[model samples]
Target: MGDASRPRFMGAALAGEAGSSRPSLESGHHSYPSFDNNSSVYALNPEHGGTESRTGSQYFNYRDDPNDVPMQPLGDSRYLDEKRATYAAPRQRSRAKMILAGVAAGVIALIIIVVVAVYFGVVKKNDNDKSTNNDSASKPSGTSGSGGKGSSSNLVVTGGDGSKVTTDNGTTFTYQNSFGGYWYWDPNDPFNNGAKAQSWTPALNETFNWGVDKIYGVNLGGWLVTEPFIVPSLYEKYPKAVDEWTLSEAMAADTANGGLSQLEDHYKTFITEEDFAQIAGAGLNFVRIPLPYWAIETRGDEPYLAKVCWTYFLKAIRWARKYGIRINLDLHSLPGSQNEWNHSGRMNDVNFLNGPMGIANAQRSLDYIRIIAEFISQDQYKDVVVMFGITNEPEEAIFGLDNLQRYYLQAYNNVRLASGIGEGKGPMISYHDAFLPLTQWAGFMSGADRIMLDDHPYICFGGQSAAPISSYATTPCKTWGANMNTSMSAFGMTAAGEFSNAVTDCGKWLNGVGLGARYDGTFAGSTAVGDCDTWTNWPAWDDTMKSGIKQFALASMDALQNWFFWTWKIGNSTETGKVESPAWSYQLGLQNGWMPTDPRQAAGVCGNTAPWDPPLAPSATGGSGAGQIPASVSNSLHWPPTTISNVGGGATDLPTYTPTGAVPTLSAETFSSASGTGTINAGNGWANSKDTAGAMVAIATCSYLDPWVGQGIAPPSPLCSGGARRRDVPLPLITPPPSPS
Candidate 1:
């Protein structure tokens, strides 16, 4: 068996070795009687990833068999009605008896007071200051324009209706800074070895063309994603959290248990505007934002479950645009767990592909994509969002290729239609390989012009995790070089969607338990050997390793059309040290001087892949076209000479057309329970019972005093107090009810 301590690719031998039955991909659907229909809204016990206890030496797949929910037949109005009824309708206070009604009224009154106080004293007062700061922070970046460069002040915001408005009035921005300071594009530095006196514009900022530009990017992991291993401190603080799904549930419980204010504060501070500035400064031109389906909302649960994160998602998009960075919006998790991994927001289920529920779940997943596509299609974000990744790291071994392909086709059409592809303005659609052989997708989306494949090739997991650090770093480039050379031939345009230098599998820190160092004593045991900084040979060995790996990274840039490093940053509380930080963190790698300080280095590799092949033009068979040097136009200007270098040779030409499309205006509650119907049902079951008397009182108590609870403010005496005995009180007064008569 492979090292159980690392990530084992399940599609390879594990299914058969474990004697797990393979359900027919083209067969009848089975109803899962034992499945918990209410699991989506309620917290299940923490025994996810199955009952098989994990040993330290075990290679961890982080997948468990899905608990299949019974699927309702489509167009069955009765079943739909029943499901709708199951959604816990907010109980009307008037429906209760007079005694309960009076109590509810009091609770409502108290809630208003608290909200008024907080809104005025906290939210309102700070809102303006935060807004001002955010605007000022975002404004220092350049304006969007063509030519070697344009003044940030001169850029104008063109309205969707083609009306122009200058940003000087504090209306909108049109440009952001391009590469000019670093050695790659710097015209001033004496030590500069590369091209200067030129401008470089990102291909993503132009039209949606895969032919001329190769994608060079980085993943924004652990920012929106609450991965236990990546942000170990979060998990360590909550003992029951085995994964993101579990952690979310625990946080929900904490909020319900009178910790709402703390939860709100957490979301406010987790990932701020500064992170975006730093990402832009690092010279990475793109970011892959891995977000869960719940970032919008999952109607069946408490608000905290969804957590009002849509605002943050929008904030991230704006920030990316402000900094001249493109975004690849990735739906990392689906309604029903797409894969059994914790990153899927559920660890025990591949519900997306299981039995009858699979179709329903697939439809739900499509709804999320459509909504996001609609948002990106708007005038402001159309070009900024370069790729709309449908899903991330799905396991086809359980989901089945037929189902995956079917959903991809449906989803592709939906996105194109919603984003108005006919107008020549839509982002590229990216789909994950799902552990299947890449050859299977040869000419998969041939009819579609801007579809691509997403593959995650990591050295820190599976069999590679056990390999020596040098072999881990140097050997993969051979496969990458060969694969990148043929990417267009095999799949339209392929990219390494998620990858990192980590070469170890230490996860004990997630549980707040310390495991002995996996490498030399100075490095964190959880860090991969490839990223470790404590070599016995000291600085010389460090320099050699960095150089070798840097070359390898450049080789990868040459091989693959585009690549995003696995992560930008891990939580500070979770980072062991600069060198021993989460090995996948690109920021830590930069701090340690292992990563390139300039984005132009990627262009350098694009210009020539020496060890692999002399710069050969892409094959004529594929849609690969020689890059065009951008010509000066009214809105468009010439980018620096070093931005894109044509491999295989051709005349310099710039793509003139900038893709534009209409942003969708969706109805309210786009994914809310009230709007849910047809195949887009929220989930299988809802709250089956009405609110109990205790539940009603508790709800009132929470609605009024939960914030106070989080703020350490005790509710007045008996009723609002945690675990305090409730006194039988008459309506409208705090005095005890006639001694309970």
Candidate 2:
């Protein structure tokens, strides 16, 4: 094992990248000794001229020249390589034999070192690279990747058989037994509404069972309940010291500045039975109606709040029933303020159902919920009103989850008691995910009850990195579709309560500071805003991007139990607004041909499972109504009109209920485009043109829509028919487009 007596040889061997080299036994410098095939016996050759012989177990020294001397005895001496060995060369022939032996030993040692260096430095390094590539595959950029936004747990993927596959992020998936069954409409189920029922059951010979059908719905936002983004004109019309605090402030201001009569007119015309009919005719079957708690209960001094909405609210229900559309009654804005958001009817305070005054507000909310639940549970509406949401988007981070959960239970129990229809037999209760991971609520309302997990998946808001117009539409949806089934398995039901086809943040009024419009021409192919200041000269939404978005939308329709676009209509605006709000309008999408004409058609297009396709479709004009109307409009106002000074309800000075007055008659130019189903100019102006379909529809005008602009590239000319026109054009029979091939 010792090399102290061995001779050293020299050959060409270089250091590797790791700086590894062979060490010579004699001189300080090390090299590989050369091997020769001619000699059989081995001789040890020193760097200096000398020879040493190896026989049996001993080393011998012999001399060929006269001056050569015998070598010192081989022993275990601790001499460093810098110290020279005390030996001289015996002869040239003996030296040659020593070189051959040294070369053979060096060659063997070099092979072993090279192999080890290659294994760790090259092969092992490649293995590490493979691990990194896997990580990027699972966690997409800008997504939590573990599951959803704000999620801490890794996703789990289970193979169909008994195998398990965990992602690099530690998400786990377990194999679930396939149910191999589908839901059929049961006449006995009270909540079935009989709309989707078939006259005869399928024959037992039928082989395929239908999967869960996707629900296509739209939120009637800014209609029954208003949001600043939906109608920024309200904010601009009624200016407050702090700008706008809540709906209460806006209501009081609108009553004072523009008179309660004008506000009433807005409520009457903003959305009507016509809107419901139009929605159904377009192929959507459901509408989520968001309402403020104040809509039902009158605060003592707030004259503007719910002064006349009780009547309109019932009218909405009647319209939905008539149109054969189911309603998801969402109590959007609760008492006090829920989680300090503007949509909660106020901003910057977590009062309603959350903080110091949370319990009191929560009790008040529960009281109203009980009333609404009992009302909707009445025989007439029990079937039409299929879902009741306790609240919308409560901020649980600021308000602890424990408090929210407690409130939910209290509200749930109250609803169940008031409803008298126990859990699954009645309408499904809906609860927002409170921005938690979708999987976090699995088995949430467990046991006997049925409930839906409402998640609002939007990509337009916040500071997410801006993507191409099409990327904004396609990327997020594709990611969601990939994991939808597993994430939704635990809930009784689930729905995307609110989503939009918007791909930009351009409506400056939406967030309260920017140019009037974000994109100038259209949204179909518009890119990210290049200059924050420049507002015009953008590309019109084109066919390719529209097609891409439609494909993504169809995929999303298959992913969730149901989905409601954020809004059905954004009122057309004249001042600092357009006659169409592309980001927020479903009608505009349909008219423009970007939105699918029918959502049910998706099941057929995707080749998954059939949707809830009814044989004889439900009627769009015949259904029972909520029997009673409000007793007194003035009494409900609680505050007197601008002419009177009374603070509280006073019987003697109350104003009798008069009609909300004629709809505001404003002059608007006709909307038509070579690119769109040209604006249908009935004598009643552009109002009657909503039903008309086009490749790019833009007709109505209010605070949302642009006015008098000729459809294609420029504004209408001076000679363009102006002013309030009567219904001259025949009403077009608006029909849903044929299903995609």
Candidate 3:
């Protein structure tokens, strides 16, 4: 765990640049003890190392692809310039002081009148003058339509066919559940004025047969109802503000006038029917849209927040119907962000689980869920894929089995009673595990009516470390400390109330050494193609392209065909895989350890480097970073405009990549390579570009999502403790690349 294990310098493959100050994998280090081939439990732990990714999350990473994205390079530094564009209020005298001036009553009245006039002037001036000022401010970074400045309100991801989101290699992707999905098509678009554009079915398939194809869904943050607060002006600085400001207090006088428009724009941009359609088409049948507790609570006396969410819910249901995408309403944030910052929206820099403030937030969250389930379920969208997440990744009881069970019990009852989802519509909920014994813990918190055991197996920061998949059975250090299935059996976790986990992003883990491959099964993996480091440059096509995706097809057929792999991909924010862990191949920023490849940097690109030894590599395998990406390259793509500011440490270290409104493109060389013999085959996991007969088809990922389970906050079904005890399916020998013809 010492910094010595990591190199003092980084082995970055800059396009043409020379050496720089990077840490090493084997510098002044505590040499890692060799792993006993017989499984003596590898000891390279991430918890006690030089880790930068903070406890919850301190820095926000930005990237192009939605995989384990390297910390986003400080993109453009101009982000801060778009600060709260507040209006300087017109100078006014204090009413108290003026009244006590010992003047005639009429004089006092005159003073009051003058003060009123000045106040009005400030308000009016802010409204009227904003046009010119805002125009310039909004236009500063371009992406504007008119020469005049554009409103930040209108700058959301618009409704258009963004199908070409990827045309290149994934150097990276995280969070922010957009409860704001499926709202793009104007129920009254001039294009479909009288078509009843908003009509859709809300009936969810409630036939609860265990092990049936249960509807699946994920949450996207919908800040539409909350974006007004996006203007930092509305929020007190998180964590350290002397006093927090409420919505009304922040927008009380001047900002309130345009609040409605701001709110509308926020919702408008949060979701689009087209986005839903894209997801639906991707095979995703359901969607869990998470709305925040704040959304329901209004600042004024009109505090019934339930009605507002219902208003939004129906709108969402109609849109999903249009796209054939089902919907499940998920409550992501409590009063604060839940399950780390990934999408909960609260700054992910701190532990929100048991923090005093986090608890109060949890209660408010329960209050909000009860409100939503109470009204929405009784209406038309009853069958909609709706459910309640008692809390997203509540970890207070993670270390304590009893606490975990008790907390969930409270969650179960709270949601059930409040939503009136009585008995059957058991909600699906997940809990984060303590770094302790997952198997032993799994049994302690078993569930009943529709309870699901959600486990987030992380390997990046102080999360779970990776051992051979087989270790799940033979190791005490791994999941439940025993066989995975056996543990699940004990906790009553069987089919139906199955388990799920977000695994390593595609290329984040293929660090094998001693082979070369390409999209066309070319002999590219040959050492002639350079060492392991050169492998990182494996054209995206060459990866699965080898032998026409026999391996990908084999793996997918093997993996997806089974009941595991909850979420297929992870952006940088998931923090589950080991990329920067010195306790890993090397440490922070991959300073030392050989540069074989950062699987996280390139998701699924398999690196044929030597065995990945802890605390650094034994030798400099040429395959170092061969097919994976480096932080330097990763520091490029800036997607959400905010990525610009996330980099550059606020300004001084800003980036130079000007994200031309142009969608980033992939090279034809990268695109044209193919391993398939022009056939469509899902069996091989390689789909065809054009749905031809023999080749498998490439489908949009979200196309697989569904949203039709109408369960109330369900209890955790019989627990599977931690999947630690699950039996590790043995890795079958890969068919050897056929001998040379």
TM-scores of the models, in the given order? 0.55, 0.51, 0.37
Candidate 2: segments with Cα more than 4 A from true spot: 1-213, 239-258, 300-304, 421-424, 464-466, 512-539, 577-580, 604-741
lDDT of each residue in 51-103, candidate 2, tens digit only? 22222332211111112212223221212222334757433335767788777
Q: Residue 409: error of model 3 in Å?
A: 1.2
**CA RMSD for every model?**
26.3, 36.6, 29.5
Model 1: which ten-residue window has the lowest total lDDT? 687-696
lDDT tens per residue, model 3, 487-605: 23344222111122111111222211111121112222211212222222223224232322222222221111112211211112123222211111111112222211111121122
State in Å the error of residue 693, model 2.
52
For each candidate, the alpha-carbon lDDT, in order, equals 0.45, 0.43, 0.27
User: What is the C-alpha RMSD, rounded to one decimal, of candidate 2?
Assistant: 36.6
Candidate number achieving the greatest TM-score relative to the actual structure: 1
Give the Cα-based TM-score of candidate 2 against the true structure.
Answer: 0.51
Least accurate 10 contiguous residues by lDDT in model 2: 5-14
